[model samples]
Target: MGYKAQFHPGTSDPSKNRKKYMDPAYKLQKIRSVSDEDVVRVLGHRQPGEDYKSVHPPLEEMGEPECPIRELVEPTPGAKAGDRIRYVQFTDSVYFAPISPYQRSWMYSYRYRGMDSGTLSGRHVVEARERDVEAIAKELIESETFDAARTGIRGRTVHGHALRLDENGIMFDAMQRYVFDKSTGEVKYVKDMVGEPVPAPISVGKPLSENELKTRTTIYRADGITIKQDAEVLQMVQNVHWERSFGGFEPFKEAKF
Candidate 1:
């Protein structure tokens, strides 16, 4: 029999959300629309109409040795074209953000190929071929995984995930990459992800309401769904903690709750 993957363990909304986000079969809901040109501008890797710079000659053009592994493995579009590697970083607010950095790493692993992801305390960065990274950034920006208010696309100065939300309920960006538009009731990016100015403001749509955020949030909070409330998740956490703490010294002993 084929093995079935259990993405997560719990019945809570956050747990369910984590599982759903990790499952590649689940199509993430599109909550907003950001133009492809705007996506390129915000990535700050290249100009809107600029050609992708290549680190090496295209696979077909390069005189390559015939290896069995290379024959069996299919190269991604960017890889085949020998595009230079680039990255996109996202910071998720702790205050009812739909997704967190750790989960973002897991989701990216399941959903993407030919890329590497790193997770920090509050930020996640995915590195891939230049064009591939741009595609990924655009999809994630438009998907439910991103909230215009709670999620930030920051290439640097990623220090606002743990801070309190601003008066407009937007995540505090020290770079001030994005601003809340009062008249349109939307969030617009005046600068690129790395803090350079863009030609025009790129609107990423309005912020989700507090109630909507709560419903979609994958974070466990005392004010909402606490981890303590989910026995299965709590048990899993304890088991992992025990293994990491004592498994090295007491390899033969069972963990006691």
Candidate 2:
């Protein structure tokens, strides 16, 4: 008999979305298109036509290492080429953003290979080989999981996820990295992820509508869909809390909630 993985437990939209995003088998819906050049510009790690920098010589050229673990596991394209490690960080607004930092970490862990992810209160950061990070960034920017207004690609000074939105319904960025264009009603990035000025504006496309955001949002908010409404999720939360509180002292005692 084999054990199957249940990504998350709950029937609510947020729970279902969390599970979907964490499942590599589920295809993420592409909601917008950003050019590869634009992706590079936003990432600010290198120029559009610049060659990827390498940390070491290619794996094949290095030779001489015959380890059982190395033979069992296949290296990623970037790893094989020994590309330099790079990172992409995202800040998700609390106001019904499509996806939050915690879920972003979970999704990345399941979908990505040879990478590391960290989740903070307001943001998530993923580090991988340079080219691989760019590919991951582009996919996430175009996916339904990202909303231009509520989701920010910030490498540093990620401070707006918990703040109130601006007049145009865009998240408040301390760096003012992106702006809402009144003419096209689109959100454009005038600066790179780290607040460095870019040569041209990179349009990530228009923000999703309020209704659309609510539908796709993986966050459970009191104003939208409260966590209390999902019985199974609430039970799981309580159980986790109970285990954390008493498990250290009473390893054999049953949790009562």
Tens digits of lDDT, candidate 1, 51-95: 999999999999779899999999988999999999999999999
After superposing candidate 2 on the true structure, give the runs of residues whose Cα lies further than 4 Å from its correct spot: 1-3
Query: Which lDDT tens digits does candidate 2 get at residues 22-131?
Result: 99999999999999999999999999999999989999999948899999999999999999999999999999999999999999999999999999999999999998
lDDT of each: 0.94, 0.93
Clashes of 1: 0
Clashing pairs in 2: none
Q: Please state the error at residue 8 of candidate 2 in Å.
A: 0.5
- Residue-pair clashes per prediction, in order, are 0, 0
Q: Residue 232 lDDT in model 1?
A: 98
